[model samples]
Target: MTELNILHHSSYPPESNGHGGSKRTAQVLELLVTNGYDYTSVDFDTIKALKTLKWQKKVSLFLGTLLRFPFKGKNISFKRLKRVDRLKFISKAFIAELSSIPDIYIWESTLDIHQFIAAELKAKGSKIIGIAHNLESLVPCASQFGAIVHHKSPINRFAQELETLSICDEIFVISREEQWLLNLFNIGAKYLPYYPIIETRNNLLEIRKRRALRQKNNEFLILGTVLNPPTLNGTIELIKMVSEVSPANAIIHIVGYGTERLKPHLTGYSQFQLHGGVDRSALEDILAKIDAVVLNQPYTTGSLTRIPEMLIAGIPVICNEAAARSFYNYSGVYLFSNEHELTDFLSNPMDTPLIPKEERVYTDLFIKTLKLAV
Candidate 1:
């Protein structure tokens, strides 16, 4: 592809602060460049929990959490602004980043409320595409935006949501699961595997293997995010169970940079390692070495890129019951719900598991969509 000005839109600061979507957004940015697309990303940070009215302070605080939000925080929007005020805040962001407009505008939306900007960009003769991570209705109750979107009355803003959804040129679905989800809204979409995919390589496999062997302690490793309201605290729960067995060689590696809520088990465990606020390469290298990647949360429609990363790295994944339902071919993947199931896998590790390297499948389709939109 020729030099394309791709405007990557996000709901969080694309910096070192701990946010999963933002981290995934950054990874995709590198992948876009590697794929020969000259791109510039525009992040419209959500303003739900964020209170700093100052622009410089808002950006600075967000960058601090960059190290561990994806896996650690249950709700990433805690640091952002409230919903009713979000668009107004984003209006400031639009004005801030307005000086630079690109050839294509790709928005990775967590909510339809942000869809208005994409539709507007498309109206301005730019290609617009969005990867919806969560259904807006579900988000209202499950998200910090829930009350804001439907504060006292869901009846009021229902019309605005529809108006926003109608304007986008094309909305991309992350998987067949998400495609089916879009049906509920009657939105047309293209299902590209890992809609915003991060690059995976075999070399990562070697790095993982070597890292595993380097550890004199032979215990299975555990690491991932633990969110607030304890919705996605599976990783913390798993550690509690694993520590019960008292394995001598095992270690728990946490990249948790989310809310500073403390778990009791973290206090006394000698094997538990908290590597927070590290750069991407350092984090990636560490992930390359772990015995098995952990996805402790229940299933959602959004595609999990780490699944591909773990698969391509030949690392087995210990996913819970919820994640197992959405993923396929468990020959190399391990599923667990309790302590007994996890302890059993720690003793017998799998060698070289399968991870789908489905880059080309989407590249062809994504380019076609861009062509049509442009």
Candidate 2:
């Protein structure tokens, strides 16, 4: 029996909204648990306790590097703890508890701190599988040279990410675009399709019922996080385009985190409604009233998990060509390029029939992705 050790940054409480990396981490664990993997999950946030605290039972404390420690620890600040000291503590505690490495180790994000630890684990006959959630190499100064392939010297966080991944037996990404970009750098990786959390209570029957109620209004909506530069700038640009072409009667609903940033931009537009972070039930209620959902992420690097969720709602989705990288071939996705194209479609939209809920099988994709990873 092959044992699996899953490593991640933090814990996702059931009620947590789970934005960004947290969401991906939760999804990965859920899939592994659901598929009957004899797995152990080690969260790094609480890993430091393993050092000073004495324990009878073997507790796992695994840390992924990319997780940002914003605040000071109880006794010592994260920055104050030297890297060498931290590494030693983790190494000693892990060896004392586990005695031997597991058959397989699936690391959530590759960080330089993990390289030495992972190398040692590999030596103990463990297969290191890295989930490259985002391409660090493309993150400008933060990562590597980004899209600059012919740079004289490549360095920074991206170098560490590449070095760590190179040591891994296999690598997986959530976006086709990322897979292509990684391949360009001569790195071998597989594209794993993203799977949204589908609940029986909020099933396809309910989604279609919501969509039916929504379609009668013929309203447009663009929703997600606007805190980041890519999403914030993209949402602003999309709004500007819509303002130029959309009819005076058109009602556009903007929801999710950082929507307050859009208030200044929509001064003249009475049709635009901004709903900042709301409860899950309230969000669903808003989605139920939205006719068509627009995804305008021109600078999105990794997979947009929200797209799959929107599709599952049985609503017509209008997004840019670049934003549709993940689902370009999916029959239900509607693609457009510029403001002219989007405005034209909005003016006299064609009949985009609701896709059967059964066809949107996220679990099937998850199963297929897991098989390819191992």
Candidate 3:
């Protein structure tokens, strides 16, 4: 059989599971390799390259900013120049690794930088497939205390996102809502549910057995980087609800990168424990001890991977409607619309049986989508 030449690109290396974005990218890469596709991977060293502004780039950026000030105002001009530099760098990085353009190019994320690279690759006669982890435009604006969070203006972000997606031959979205939104814009999008890297059936059964044994004190888990706006917002709301409703014996464990930043908000809540950025083994150990996971996101954007991860582990997930958007039908997921509802569920949490089915459904769907797109 002749191998299909596929190229995957992302801002972060697919092997890195330090964050949700990387984990999602890794899942796609794994699927490609497992399906026997001959693929090339290119990633922008986000931390070392794209994020860092060297003196030379700074000077170029300043000059470029001044040059475009007459046409686009200083602030917009500066943002545009910086974006161009990042896009140029990404295109150059991918080209340096390319011996020949692959038959298909799959770029990750909805960021303008990735779109720019995708457009460039498409120009070179390669089929372009975009993996939109989240529609950045749909992510709600956030604020801390009284200060507005710094980010691209929503209008500009939405415009850029539309332009980026318009160039794609096909797009893979993480949630049904996102797919619907894209369809409204006449963009051909496919809903690809997240495929979590989970333990074997035997291991999951063991986890279910452990979960079935009711402890004297209920333990709940909330997993996400607190630095993220949506998570931070949801966590604060959860803390308030749990504090008011949870019994003195209950414990809420918060784990993820930047969770330590929640210290100030958690001051008087002794029931909440923050475990900042634990490894896979550590997370598994924690999962074994927890009865349920809580996801109280105020607004929906991308599908949260933790939903599937928890369900696959046989752990119950108590989430708000927004957090449970794409996962409504998944086994072991319970949705709450208000604090009263959340309290009721926590008092007598539902049992989440182990999901023994392999992720072949996701794999088959992904392969089918690729074939149609190609």
Best by lDDT: 3
lDDT of 3 by residue, 303-333 (tens): 8876776776788889888889887877788
TM-score of 2: 0.76
- Estimate TM-scores for all models: 0.68, 0.76, 0.85
lDDT (10s digit) by residue, model 1, range 1-374? 55666877676654323455665566556556666777666544543334446787556545544543454444334344333335644644573456555667777763555654665566667766766544444322344353223333343344444455456567765566667756566777666554223323445555556655543234344444445323245555666766676357676666655523434558888877766446657766766556666556544435454565566666777777755543566445788777778777666656667545455766677676765665
Mind giving the per-residue lDDT tens digits that candidate 2 earns over 237-322? 88888888876688888987888878999998887888877777777777777667887876546776666666666666788876
Better of 1 and 3 by TM-score: 3
Sort by TM-score, top down from the best: 3, 2, 1
Q: What are the lDDT figures for the candidates, one per model?
A: 0.57, 0.63, 0.73
What range of 10 consecutive residues in model 3 has the weakest lDDT sum?
A: 142-151
Model 2 has an lDDT value of: 0.63
Runs in model 2 lying further than 4 Å from the true structure: 1-17, 45-92, 113-116, 139-160, 200-205, 213-216, 350-374
Off by over 4 Å in 1: 1-6, 13-19, 27-40, 43-104, 110-113, 122-127, 136-141, 146-148, 151-166, 195-206, 209-218, 227-232, 244-249, 265-290, 324-326, 337-339
RMSD of each: 9.1, 7.1, 4.5
